[model samples]
Target: MNYLAHLFLAKDTPESLIGNLLGDFAKGSVKFLYTEEIRKGIELHRSVDTYTDSHPIFRASKRLIAQPRRKFSGILVDVFYDHFLARHWSEYSDVALEAFSSHVYKILVDNQAILPTSLLQIIPMMKAYDLLASYQEIGGIDNALRRIATRIRWQNNLADGIEDLIANYQQLEADFCAFFPELIDYAQTYCYQADRPLA
Candidate 1:
């Protein structure tokens, strides 16, 4: 699944209704994806008092969790999808919207237990049905999802706002800038767009 689908499924489907659906799907895809192990690692990392002598996955999870800025960036994406995308479903194509929605619902159903609480809360409040029912929409859902995901990616890059200074200080300024022009653009766009206080 694309990042948008992953985000929507991981964070936007209704928990009560999709619980069983997720379980069935998880039996197949979840194992293949090692999602359970990844989730366990993520959980272990979140608990600060836990020792890091467990395993490789646990250690990686701890590192990921230690980067709180990334976590916050994920939260911002969740907020945008829940508050904006879900409310404007009518503006999307029926086939694309349904396909995207079904994909998201299935994934949520499959990974219901491991999903973060920040994600679960967004699910029950989705306005997909209301949006879909009223309008004979066209291609907007795909566009919107893509746009939001791009915005999230950009925000994540900008979360490390000292990129130029770091590159220069590290004596790889030319090489770093040459290798990451898009990343630089993402950071710039994110800085321009973000309204909330950055961490």
Candidate 2:
């Protein structure tokens, strides 16, 4: 999952949303810095990433990519899944994607002072570009991957690797359709079992 999915999975609180978004930057034991609810959101973010990486269905999706681009398949698939989630947002939730996107952007922007240092730098760009609303288009995925490629340490080929996603688009959508519902269920159950909020 990526930013939108993490936010979608977060409990409806400013702190929880901030914590979930912080997962990308706050590695290791750093989540302990937050309140219990925020910590739960951070923990949920890691759990979702671990679950997505290990699931047989997600692994199957990664295998569909060509061998040459296989090394970056996980990153590609994560973005691809968000595209599907945005495209099919109406089917999954009653809230319109545009409205939800605006809401999340407001939450992040309004609470900027509380955000992790890394996220504070990125959130402005995300809101300015309207990333969540743009995910319905393949071009958005391409642009996002290319931007990611420039930031990474390695000689990542993500700029050209969007083709892998374009080529296997249908199968990847099917895979996301199959996997996301299960993931939502798992996340809900996890939060419930942990005595944390799910919405």
Candidate 3:
């Protein structure tokens, strides 16, 4: 899961949404930095990442990546899964994808004071491109992969990850369909702390 999926999995609250998103930058302990609710959201985000990365179905999808880009397989699959989730957004949520995207962007911006600097920097682009909803198109994902490629410090072809996805689109979609539901169940039931349920 990437941004869209992480946000989708978050409980329907501003604090929860911010917390889960902070998972990417709020490394190590969040103890004194954020409110307890936000910290729980970050914890939930970590739990989701651990479960997704270690799942058998996700591992199977990673094997479909071409050898040259094998090292970035995890990144590829994470974005790919987001693509599918966006593509099939209606099945999971009643909210329009665009509406949902706008809502999340507002939440991030309105709560910017508590957000990390790294995330604050991308807000303009995220809304400009409408990135969350854009994942529904392969071209959008391709553009995303290209941008990600440039961000890598090493000389590599993470952009070619799109080809692996295209070549195995059907199988990978099948894998996502199979894996995501199980993940949703796990996330729904997971406790961020021993006492707090996700919702």
Q: Please provide, for model 2 over 109-162, each residue's C-alpha lDDT reduced to its tens digit, 9 standing for 90 to 100.
A: 898766778788878788888988888998888888888899899886778877
* Candidate 3, position 3, lDDT: 84
- Give TM per candidate: 0.25, 0.93, 0.95
Which tens-of-lDDT digit does each residue in 23-133 have in candidate 1? 322332333433433432222222211221233322332233224444443332222223233334444224455566566555554665766464465445333443222
CA RMSD per model (angstroms): 16.6, 2.5, 2.1
lDDT of model 2, residue 95 = 89
In model 3, residue pairs whose N, Cα or C atoms come closer than 3 Å (at least 3 residues apart or on different chains), thus clashing, are: none
Displacement of residue 163 (Cα, Å) in model 1 is: 30
The lDDT of model 3 is 0.91
Among all candidates shown, the one with the greatest lDDT: 3
lDDT of 3 by residue, 5-59 (tens): 8889988999889888888878888888998778888989999999999999999
Q: Which stretches of candidate 1 lie over 4 Å from their true place?
A: 1-95, 127-199
Q: How close is candidate 2 to the true structure, as a TM-score?
A: 0.93
In order of listing, the candidates' clash counts read: 3, 1, 0
